[model samples]
Target: MSILREARLSDLPAIETLVKAAYGHYVDRIGTIPGPMRDIDDHRYARHIEAGHVSLLFDNADGEESVDAGNGDKPVGLLVLIPQTDTLLLDNVAVAPSAQGRGFGKALMQAAEARARQLEFDSITLYTQELMHENLAIYRRYGYVETHRAEEFGLKRVYLRKSLA
Candidate 1:
């Protein structure tokens, strides 16, 4: 079972560790550590947690497929959302490598859209590295359309957006 809920400040260490475990493998394929690995630190994670934008999707193996999972949530997924006037920016979405193929990532995406709708945003926007073909395809499959491409932090980025209405 998987549980999704807002992240607490105390989850900083777990968040940092999970982000690394989630994105570390990309360092070899992309020739650099992805932005999420470098960015998920105490300061940044704390800032987002305080703003109520960081959510965690925990796996409760002992539970019987429950959404809340009570208090037995374990390591799994992390999502970061930054609200803009017109759209919710998905700052980061990472799932622990060990937890892949378990639908945790998909759950996080659904959570992001629900949060965006709750905040009254019309759409969601996000960006991924140009070299991350798998992620791009998944985003497209989930209804995100490429808006443009740009370079930031010396890396080529493909920006995409999805309308909620």
Candidate 2:
């Protein structure tokens, strides 16, 4: 089972670590990290959490039907879903390095889609750096169609959206 919940102030530290770990390598490859990663002074994560825009998802280890032993309520992944004026934006999704190969990202995205549907959102959108081919492919596989392209924060990026209605 998986548990998805709104983020709390206490969750910021862990969330920051998760985000940095997930994107650090990509930053090195891009030659310049985006502001979210670069200018995040201590005040930022807490501010975002307070704004209620971020969310955390945990895998219920005890609920997994595996032969191996199970754990409980351990934070395995996270994502920030931002509600724009007209569209739902998937800001960021990061699975712990140890949890990368699992389907956590897909599960998180599915949850995001379900949320959009419940809110009557017409579309869901996101932006990914052009060099992040792996993420671009993942979004493409899940029906996100590219609508625009640009260079932002010194990295080429593609904007994608999925029409929900």
Candidate 3:
């Protein structure tokens, strides 16, 4: 099983490492550093943690003891959830490359849905680069529908939304 909890300041380093490992490969495919790669900085994480917008998903399958036990339960995935008036924006979801095929990404999406419900959101929204076919497929498989397409910051972005109610 995996545990999801708010990220603490101490987890910043590990979170940064995970984000880099997860998004570094996309730099070549997209011809530029992905948004997540450019945005995953310690200051940004600190701000998000302070605002209660970041969550770390820990994999316990390895029988890890605790997050505070000196890297025992290192995070396998991270999420940046921003709650809006009627929706939760899934700004970022990154699963460490080493942990990729273990269902962590799907687990994190499920967690994000739960979070949206808990926060009383009626829907959730996210956007991905138009070139990221795999991501688009995964979001679609999770029931997200494309709402529109636009060029943002010079990247063609496909916005998607899933209604919860």
Residue 130 error for model 1, in Å? 0.5
Better of 1 and 2 by lDDT: 1
TM-score of each: 0.90, 0.86, 0.92
What is each predicted model's overall lDDT from 0 to 1? 0.86, 0.77, 0.86
Residue pairs with backbone overlap in model 3: none
**Which lDDT value does model 2 have at 107?**
92
User: What's model 2's lDDT at 100?
Assistant: 84
Error of 2 at 134 (Å): 0.6
* Candidate 3 weakest ten by summed lDDT: 64-73
lDDT of 1 by residue, 63-88 (tens): 86653423544559989999988899
* Winning model by TM-score: 3
Off by over 4 Å in 1: 64-73
**Residue-level error in angstroms, candidate 1, position 51:** 1.4
Give every collision pair in model 1. Answer: none
Displacement of the residue 97 alpha carbon in candidate 3, Å: 1.1
- lDDT, model 1: 0.86
